[model samples]
Target: MNSWVNASKFFTGASTVGSIAIPAILKHAGIIGWGALAMELSSFFIFVIAIMCYMSMYDEDGYSSMI
Candidate 1:
């Protein structure tokens, strides 16, 4: 849960043309769009991948508690 939420925040910040997709959607439709949906999904998967990677590395490094 911790890794997921952290990754979520980081991904949303930089996804879709870098850090501004959600704002653009709000200005246009007062809601997010398909592109934004794509961004979220892609970002989420990428983040999950990152988390898995970090988890593996942490284990290798003998770090038990994840940040």
Candidate 2:
């Protein structure tokens, strides 16, 4: 009967921890999703910044030149 009591205690502890952790796991995944999106958008912004810099540097006597 002691073994049964120990087994019950173990499962009860595991269930309690699992109940607390499931929502935390989902929240972590959601945060990672947004982090990935932010990383992608930052890369896109870097490309845009590079293009603007290149364009501004290519002006010829206030005249626009196409590359």
Instruction: Please state the error at residue 4 of candidate 1 in Å.
Output: 18
Clashing pairs in 1: none
RMSD per candidate (Å) reads 9.4, 22.9
Tens digit of per-residue lDDT, candidate 2, span 8-57: 99998897566546545655778546555556556656876998999998
List model 1 lDDT by residue over 1-67, tens digit each.
Answer: 9999999888866664453455555647848666776777677679779988988877643555554
Which ranges of candidate 2 are over 4 A from the true structure? 31-67
lDDT comparing candidate 2 with the true structure: 0.70
Residues forming the 10-long window of minimal summed lDDT in candidate 1: 16-25
Candidate 1 local Cα displacement, residue 1, angstroms: 18
Measured by TM-score, how close is model 1 to the native structure?
Answer: 0.40
TM-scores for all candidates: the values are 0.40, 0.43
Prediction-by-prediction clash tally: 0, 0
